[model samples]
Target: MNYLELYILAAFFVTTYGNFLDVSVWEDNPEECGRTRFENTTLDVADYSKARVGQFPWVAMIGSIHPDNQILFFCGGSLISKSYVISEAQCGRLGQLVRLGSIKAEDTEEEKDCDECGECALPPQDIKVRKQIFGNDCSLNSVQRIIILELEKPAEYNDFVRPICIPTDAFCHTSRIRQRALTPGFGHIFSTLVGVTERKEKFDDMRYVNSAIVTQEECNAIYPDLLKDGEFCVDYPKGVNHSCVGDTGGPLVEYLKVKGVARAFLIGVAKINPLICEAEDTAPIVYSSVCNYSEWISNQIVSSIEAERKQGRRLFAV
Candidate 1:
């Protein structure tokens, strides 16, 4: 092997290693060591309306093993069916509870304005969870009729963060479908102050991170085996906005309804392209087709609503 041949071999190895890492491994901070390891490119994130990086309103649905409910399974879910906090079963280990809604999503002077789900100028809505019932295995939760997380507002359904329609059919085909609508509790955001400063000091610039919907085939190539048969993935755009530790349980929403919950939060599986690993860019993400499990979700919704009615009639003494 001459020097030139050796150089060619070295270049080939380098390119192969980079590509291999691209499809499977990522460096959260390759500059750091331990936290830096192979991660799924398809993870989601959570936010605090603009108040903080990954704080309140992004609840972590914690649970317990012996029914005492201790382990914290922090998935990001919204107040949509505040009466029934929806999330993934595998992430459900038992006695789960919601967390921090203290922070408000009001906008800072920099970002100017947004919507109810955004940086609304007014004080954001807040509530304490009276009770929450997600399936430990949709079967058992159904048997015991305590499904509703019990909220007092159907009025919450005006425009921002209302319950999206659940697909009537649960088992839909993912084989050839190319596009989908996805939503997440996570948003790639910069403080409104930052936006203002950037505008004032530098050229006009806008940067935010939110989840996207990608094709199954493209996602499959990058995420060849991370999913377990029926499961899929979703992500905000890349960079500071992609779904991170807090956006679990949040909806992978589409149209104006709940299509899927962000399971990537607790599941901890993603594999992003190294080139786009930390850029303020967007990439269509994937989601577990909840449409495939429509019947199961419907049963939960039906059972919960019926019980709510019966309890109401009983209170009225009808």
Candidate 2:
């Protein structure tokens, strides 16, 4: 009623919200270091200056929007299709900006040629939302177009790095045997983690992290339990990293089909990194399984693509 009464109510709301862990704990990660799958390693890897797919371009997302649209603060995303994009539903809630086709990714090179087109290269694919779906609650994206991309049969969630890729006859294959999948994201260099490692090399410090798809075994080692029922995983004996932060909603693809999505996997999701980073040994990164939900994934991408078609965007026909 009065100014003092209003102040009391405001204070109550502030206190309530302050104690809320509702905010994603992911910030404690890349904010202070790198995203989960993308461990802050001292290994001198690839250069981010190139635009590649199934690797970095597919795994990154856009950052908080900028009023001036010159250089966008991009996150990470996975290219699931020529039209669809996937990432954590939470990003939508956090006011995170997600423009599927617009993303260049963590290690992308600026060129007009890097669009999703023929397989084995980035598709000249575009991103346009048609029907967005949420599973649990209003805790999902603000965008109403979201549709559920779930397994044929619903399953428990895993806190792992699972990504999804849109599938098309021209864009995918059925074989599960995989290798050197790509993943990427933008975050602090390994230097951000001061006392986390014992690598005694300086050159290792100059590397930029890129995106690539990895095997489930490689990734599951960090958090074995993350490979839930509906979810699937992949590994790269050659160091295919898991989908990390700035990579939420990105695709965890295999050849072509959209498989998993990137997220912390806390609220009912599998903990992709069971151990996350326990041993310093040279082990591979574990990725959350996406293909396991082939049925659900199919429905999701199909629905999304069809919607896109209606909106004037050409989509791959199953």
Candidate 3:
């Protein structure tokens, strides 16, 4: 179906069924279906730098409870629907919340400093994560380790907040390989090639690095045990750019031309790699293939909604 039709259908399902929202309806739409674009916008994926304020509305900053009784930007995540945020199994805990609509402030190290960064302020909706499911089991570094978080309430769609499209299995397995994609996150920004010159301070905006998908053979050589079925690898261009500590669980999205329109698709989830920040050209960065676990994600969302309906209250799955 077309973009408009898909949106209407999705709304209808939520209204009529009140629990079961068809995940495939929007999945079939163009990748740019729910994004907010402005005229005269210029994006440079090659150089790789901080993103515009609202350039990626579907991106969310995950906040997990710390031992000090404060919330922190534990990891990155992507908003897949009004009620779910797709993240990595190890990145977020079950009781944490995800922040949307605003960019993370630059040069902010603590939560107090974030509150003063006016434009980077968070949205009012504090959607608590009601349930967290990592496919069949919480196996780290695997596609099955995708964490599907059910928000306590449905997020309101707007210019500053939106959702990205999840591709079908065919699209991920056949089409996305060997394609150029953007990996955005709040990771560390290294000045020189050595250690982090600007460490601990978060960027004022989302940082994006361009990467090209590589064949499984190339990645398999580096990660013999980690590279498995339903997982893919990307190669960072010859440069000093790559994902850092805070980038894991973030979206690895690719833009495609659908009927003369540029659309975005969530192809994979960024896996943790301490060595990748300094790794250069042809260095393979692994990601959990999103398309491979599409079935498990949809099933979890549907099942969570059904459970919430039956219980007549919110439920948190351990």
Candidate 4:
């Protein structure tokens, strides 16, 4: 090929796929976590409906495999690292398989292709749970309902599967209060009454809702007994209901600019609410504060790696 022709071809390639190439530098660096490879340029963050593929790559579906080989997903969680997922204690007993990289709730195929742009995602990962570590104050009555699930192997990173950043000191102090955040999950989308039977329709696709942070005093007025020191609440927009059944243990994320790049941070985990789907409008959702448990999370991960090394097993090298 002539030099002039080669230069033209290279320019066309850069113009068409420059954004994808720009983020490749962070693909292997654990320190540069929480950035999505595929940017959702179409949808606005204020949209409170179905989420676009590759928008929130760290959202995980926690489920169990039955003896008949059927998977029953009952909860949601966030992938904090290649080897660990942060969830609630209630989900610790329920999670046998942690699914990542796909938005579909039930699909036979290993990989999902985006219909909008004709881009194909890597195969979805169904990693086994090697261990379940509960928080120090985890209990039925306590608001500290945190649990960290250790995956049997490190999840391979791709355009659709990556880790969300843990909250930094600055993020916790500045961005977590009186600010709107996002909660994503693959849960019940809606319900209907057929004759006498009220049937709740499970969502086939993942969805997200934008909600505002509720102050402790405001949340206490609603559930005084349930609101505790290490917990916070978020209220959905008017006429919008979210964080329903099967969403427990999912993440409440806050987006902020880090070094001129937009990034997401894990701020809260969805705490189980009995009236989640029942009260459509007025119910404020509670979440376990990830900021308060940051130290505990770090300590557990360090100890878990040590324990695994003693037995000749190496966890994901994050």
Candidate 5:
């Protein structure tokens, strides 16, 4: 089905069966963020590989509906809270519809595609955007190319949909150089052909790449004058893996143990790179650092609630 059709179908399910859906507005709890029951056990494979169902609970598919009613999924994002998502500023105006809890991008049914192991995820949640907040210095050349999206309504957290943790002060201060990170998205599997008339094939199921954070010095060596204060670089140990087209605005996360529990922490927002998935050129992907904007994010969330309250809208804790 087309994008508009899929959205209409999703709305029908919520409207007709709203009472039976396992829906609840999650409280804003740092400890609870980034905790997921599903474990991705396919780490031994190549860095570029298909993600298992429910592997990345915070990954969001950002799509825009055209005048013709066709939907184009141009970017990926991460759910930072029940009411907010973090993505690249470039994706801010492109689309507002956010799809969560599905590994297969084409699955329009309320319930996502089940795996061979009989593992099934909860129905995908399609949320509309209420507001878009761009970073103060967001621009193509700027390192702070981040955008925050406020959902029309709070999302209900479940086994298939959850939030990833923003970096705490403690986590940011520690050395992160050479630390491994994962970036999941429903990006195109192949590089765009310059003169080809046919459309490029995209990943039907979302895929993730395993890469490591490189030191600023290492990043500068490749792209001098590109590495800035609010950005970091990531590169796969094996040169074949790289973020492709449609992967922009997705989260670059690190799995770390916090208080004796392993959680995925948001480290960066995938920056838009002109050179993507080129086999010959293995340039590290640059991402806007999330740690640098933790304070800004907090302030925006607070300000949003205050603004809503002034307008007399009943706001719940997120």
Candidate 6:
């Protein structure tokens, strides 16, 4: 092909696929990696009030707008990048908007000033679903949704807002296993003296549980079918709290020590296991393994940008 033809093809490729790697702000100096939290504690509890403010910066609430114009929380999600959220496919069903910088459930109500933090509250940022679920692979069935939120403007990062790293399989294999990972979301506490009874109403105060990674054999035993590719389970044995309803699509995060400092990375996406979650004895809480789909997650982010660029070109051509 002549130089002119080659130029045209090159231009087409660039216009069709915007350069995402060059534009993403996810890359930062290693020293400045995880700086969104205020406090770090060794306590093991499920209470949101005890949680350090801005502890889970990537934790997001997926919301839906009611007819009366009020927003309601339906499921939880994790901000993997500035523009992408990784969540369970089921939670993306009514997903319309995503709110960030909230440590409490009631913080979603309105943007208010935090006297202690000395900064005004951040409002919920709107987002769009960029990619659908992968094809009928039962093994990867748990990884259901990827939403690309529309940011009105670039979000200002402070101590309360930051993105979490999506870990590759290599990272998990080398450093993630056997480490305690934290899963945070809002849900009800159930008590079962006679039967499963709701001891407390689901509140907005974020609740969390620290889960330990379990072997594939232990995870598969909970279900009749064998564990599929890209899936694993975490132990939430008796007396150990597990994720329940209202926390779907939330992240299973771990702080991997790098150079003696722990940096947080999203390791799993919480999945439903009604029997295990309720009983809290034998069965384990299943998670859609993030390490298995690390490549797919990267592709979706880039591909989504490409799709958007192509659409823009079409509109201009028209």
- lDDT of each prediction vs. the true structure? 0.32, 0.32, 0.63, 0.69, 0.70, 0.56
For residues 1-318, write the lDDT of model 6, one tens digit per residue: 345433443354345334213212222212333445543332364332324457667777776677887776666787754555667665565667677777666444555524244544465455544344342342334333333343323344556667776664457567445667776776522111122223234554665666778877666676648466777777643454334633667778776554545667777877654444456334566777776666565554445445667788322110
Measured by TM-score, the strongest candidate is: 5
- Models, CA RMSD each: 20.7, 17.8, 6.7, 10.9, 9.3, 7.4
Q: Candidate 5 on 163-209: residue-level lDDT in tens?
A: 89887576788888987777777762211223111124556777777
Spell out the clash pairs found in candidate 6.
Answer: 89-144, 105-204, 127-149, 127-150, 128-149
- For every model shown, what is its TM-score relative to the native structure? 0.43, 0.40, 0.75, 0.81, 0.81, 0.71
Q: Considering summed lDDT, which 10 consecutive residues are worst modelled in model 3?
A: 188-197
The TM-score measured for candidate 4 stands at 0.81
lDDT of 3 at 97: 78
Q: List runs of model 4 lying over 4 Å from the truth.
A: 1-29, 38-47, 110-118, 188-199, 242-246
Ranking by TM-score: 5, 4, 3, 6, 1, 2
Candidate 2 per-residue lDDT, tens place, 69-132, comes to 4323322344332233344444333323333322343323345323244324332232233344
Check candidate 4 and list the clashing pairs: none
- Give the alpha carbon lDDT tens digit for every residue of 1-318 in model 4: 345433443443334324222342222124436788754222334445766667788988887789997887777888987788998777776679999988777754745646345666667889999889986665665555788999988788777888887874555666556787777887622211111112155567787777778888898998878677888888776656444633778888777665567778788888756445655455777888888887677667666655766889744443
- Tens digits of per-residue lDDT for model 3, 41-76: 224456557665556778877775668856655567
RMSD of 4: 10.9
The local lDDT score (0 to 100) that residue 192 gets in candidate 2 is: 15
- Which candidate leads in lDDT? 5
The residue-by-residue lDDT of candidate 1 on 75-109, one tens digit each, is 33433233434444323323244432322222132
